[model samples]
Target: MNGSQALSITDRKADEQAMIAAHNCAVARSFHSYFNQYILTDHERGYIVIDEGDYGALPQHLMDRVVDAVPSKMIDEH
Candidate 1:
């Protein structure tokens, strides 16, 4: 669905739930170092920033999934 189109109440809530689930799953699977330094600014706009030392440890696939789960408009492509 396009970003501008308003989601139904149910759809909006479901999306919110999915994002929450995704965030929880990511945290559970991620290393403790990630949590220590990570900050979740928004479910959509912000992303987890791994410290330089831990960056390579994160699985690329998981990162991709998290990015996909986030609202497209909120992602900072730059």
Candidate 2:
């Protein structure tokens, strides 16, 4: 609603579910999800997708590193 007027990426439980499904689909087939990607939508702002990597290869120690690298969460607050 401000600046670029794009919607926000308010991630959801379904997003997590889709991630699981995609992961399962990938593993059951050929190390790749049948969908290869899933999206998060904000009707006003738009959408975002997740469809990369092999099962989100996250190591225990790297959790903080990855979390730290994500963009700001206050995008829609203003």
Candidate 3:
């Protein structure tokens, strides 16, 4: 690949790693107990609700990855 393209890939990887670290930190801090629950709902058009009261507005592609990575479920009763 070209130099610019390779650099872009590297930069994207770094950004993704940073985001994952941040998400882990946030999840750990919010859930005090041993078991933590997270929910994903459409907040805006591109954003999603992560662990009630916390929202992350990521790109559509990134949103898909986040959804896949996190354990999410719907509460029909609520």
Candidate 4:
């Protein structure tokens, strides 16, 4: 989706589902940091952390990384 069509997480669960559909990809939003870290191995993992956080919680750098992320043939061991 474009900037004008960007989503806001007013309702956590619903917004998350919408974001996933907008991206047309698999996404994971969790309160556990470990869950986000673990999904790094999956290419389509749209990891979002909601550990006592809301829409504006994640840093811009992380968001940038998320946007830049693309599927890769090489797997991440970390």
Candidate 5:
């Protein structure tokens, strides 16, 4: 890769790492319980997951906020 392309990849990786850290910190402070927070991205799609196990385990307000933040197409049906 060219120098510019290499730099771009480095910058993107740094940005993604920052995003992951921020999301994990937010989930920890906001949820007040154990949960897995993931920010996944690929060629086709990107999405965030705040999994608190079963669907019923997730708070409605938090779920609503998550849904509102993410695009419908990014969310997996099942």
Candidate 6:
């Protein structure tokens, strides 16, 4: 999504759900982070699609990543 159309997290460092998207630990950037951000909308509930997380995939793989998160500011509604 473009910057203007993209969602905003007022508190980038908020404690709701924090999965670092970048680091120097040599992790691949090919994976996606905060997927719930795409599924969540204002005044809506957001959750992980697969509770088990990354079925059949090896741990730490890109498909293995699942984040049940919305913007930090939106977390208060829950």
Tell me the spans in candidate 4 whose CA falls farther than 4 Å from its real position. Answer: 1-10, 25-68, 71-78
Ten-residue region with minimum lDDT total, candidate 6: 21-30
* Per-residue alpha-carbon lDDT of candidate 6 for residues 1-78, written as tens digits (9 for 90 to 100): 766673457544432332343221112311333222311112232222331223343245433344333322222233
Clashing pairs in 1: none
* lDDT (10s digit) by residue, model 3, range 16-54: 665566557546645443222333333342223244324
TM-score of each: 0.38, 0.28, 0.34, 0.21, 0.33, 0.17
> How well is each residue in 1-78 modelled by candidate 4, as lDDT tens digits?
766675566656765664555343322333222223211122354343232233344566455545322222233467
lDDT of 5 by residue, 1-78 (tens): 765555478777876776666565545544443434433333333334554433545565555545312212223335
The ten-residue window of minimal lDDT in model 1 covers 68-77
The number of clashing residue pairs in each candidate reads: 0, 3, 0, 0, 0, 0
Task: Kindly report which residue pairs in candidate 5 clash with one another.
Answer: none
Over 4 Å off, model 2: 1-11, 31-78
- State model 3's lDDT: 0.45
Ranking by TM-score: 1, 3, 5, 2, 4, 6
Model 2 TM: 0.28
Model 5 residue 71 CA deviation (Å) reads 16
When 1 and 6 are scored with lDDT, the better candidate is 1
Question: What residue pairs are clashing in model 6?
Answer: none
lDDT of 2 by residue, 1-78 (tens): 668664345465555555555444434443233333333333453333344343464445433322112222222333
* Superposed Cα RMSD, model 2: 15.3
Q: Total backbone clashes of model 6? A: 0
Candidate 1 residue lDDT tens string, 1-78: 687899899988876776566566455544433222232334464444333235544456545533432211222345
